[model samples]
Target chain A: MARVVVDVMPKPEILDPQGKAVTGALQRLGFAGLAVRQGKRFEIEVDGEVTDERLDEIRRAAETLLANTVIETFAVSVETQEQAAAQGQPA
Target chain B: MARVVVDVMPKPEILDPQGKAVTGALQRLGFAGLAVRQGKRFEIEVDGEVTDERLDEIRRAAETLLANTVIETFAVSVETQEQAAAQGQPA
Candidate 1:
């Protein structure tokens, strides 16, 4: 199975309240000099090889359901075997 | 400034209702043969250079505040200039 990763992040111009709260909490806990923006990550397991058409379909899925295009942007990447192994998954 | 990305994901055996819903939704939408697991991604902008000690500190912070170790796992990595440029950010 091939795994694809889709990351959805708020637009740079958008205000991320969740990220702001975490930043404040971190600062209160003495972790300083850090600014954070929180987003979503989706790991998709595909049944077969990832062809260009499959990737395009995944991109469309990301655009339609995974991200709010007006306020967020999404990026899709296929995970390599090495990456999967690094993450402690069976390669 | 340096950017560090922290990804927190649920343990593989854990139930992911959100992901299940999305998977069902996608299948219903005619995107088939795919399974998805959802997680969180944090983009942290550091004030200065990222030294080893700083990386350790961030790891601690991730353990303490960013991830619930009982049910989730986290990984930290520094974003390269090439990745930033690919993402349409000023490198």
Candidate 2:
């Protein structure tokens, strides 16, 4: 099995009200920052090995369903079980 | 400036209906996998240097505002602009 992480974020040009709200909350909480952009993250646990073809399939999934391509972009990363464990997460 | 990524995910014991919906969508779209879990990702660009104190503050932000501790857990990563650029993202 393999674990894949997909991060879906809005285009920088688009306004992110949720992010802006969090930014405001952070400021009220005494943490100053440049900006905050909120997005979606998907952690997929797949059966079998992760091949190049599978990676392409995952990209398609991101483009077609995981993200709204017109206003959002996504990046995909394959994570090893060991790496997930090191991060204190079960894969 | 530094870009910090906070990934907030539901606890394994908690049910993720959104993830289940996405999983069904993916299978319907002809993509096969074991399971899919969805969560939130925050990309925060902060001013000044990223010190340990600042990292703690980010953690606090994550704990207090970014994640609902009762049902979700979050992980934080500090990314350098160079690293973000390498990943083809603007920091």
Candidate 3:
């Protein structure tokens, strides 16, 4: 099976209160950083290879239901067990 | 600045209603997929290099504030703007 990962992030202009809360918690926990932005990640497992057409369809799904396009932007990546193993990454 | 991405996913045994809902929506939208797993992604921008120590700190943050370790698992990645540009990937 092919695993497609869609990451939906808020637009830079949009306010991310959840992210802010996390940042606050991080600071309270004594972690230091510039900033934190929270987002959503969807892992879709599909049968067979993820062809160009399949990717296109997944992108459409991302745009329609996986993201709030009005305030968010998304990026897609494909992962497979074989590829993960090749890269020494766990699946 | 460096960008650290933390992906938190539910344990295999846990129920993911959000993911199921999305999968159902996609099928209704005429898109076919095997299954969908929903998760959270945190984008943290930190100043200076992301040293091993810093990564460890981020991992701690992930475990403490970014994930409910009892039912979730998390992975972290570091991204730099220059690296993204070099790879022709959007930052």
Query: Candidates sorted by TM-score, descending order?
Result: 1, 2, 3
Candidate 2 lDDT at B21 equals: 93
Q: Compute each candidate's TM-score over C-alphas.
A: 0.95, 0.92, 0.89
Report the CAPRI category for model 1: medium
Interface RMSD of 1: 4.0
Residue B59 error, candidate 3, Å: 0.7
Q: Name the lDDT of candidate 3.
A: 0.80
Chain B alone, model 1: TM-score? 0.93
Tens digit of per-residue lDDT, candidate 2, span A1-90: 789988888888899999999999989888876479999989999899989988888888888889887888788889987757754541
lDDT of 1 by residue, B1-91 (tens): 9999888888898898999999999999999999999999999999999999899999999999998888888888899987765655211
- Point out the higher-scoring one by TM-score: 1 or 2: 1
Off by over 4 Å in 1: A89-91, B89-91
Question: If the candidates were sorted by their lDDT against the true structure, best first, what order would they fall in?
Answer: 1, 2, 3
lDDT of candidate 3 over A1-91, digit per residue (tens): 8788888888888999999988998888888765899999888888888999888888888888888888888887888676434323211
**Between the candidate structures 2 and 3, which one is better when assessed by DockQ?**
2
Off by over 4 Å in 3: A82-91, B82-91
Clash-forming residue pairs, model 1: none
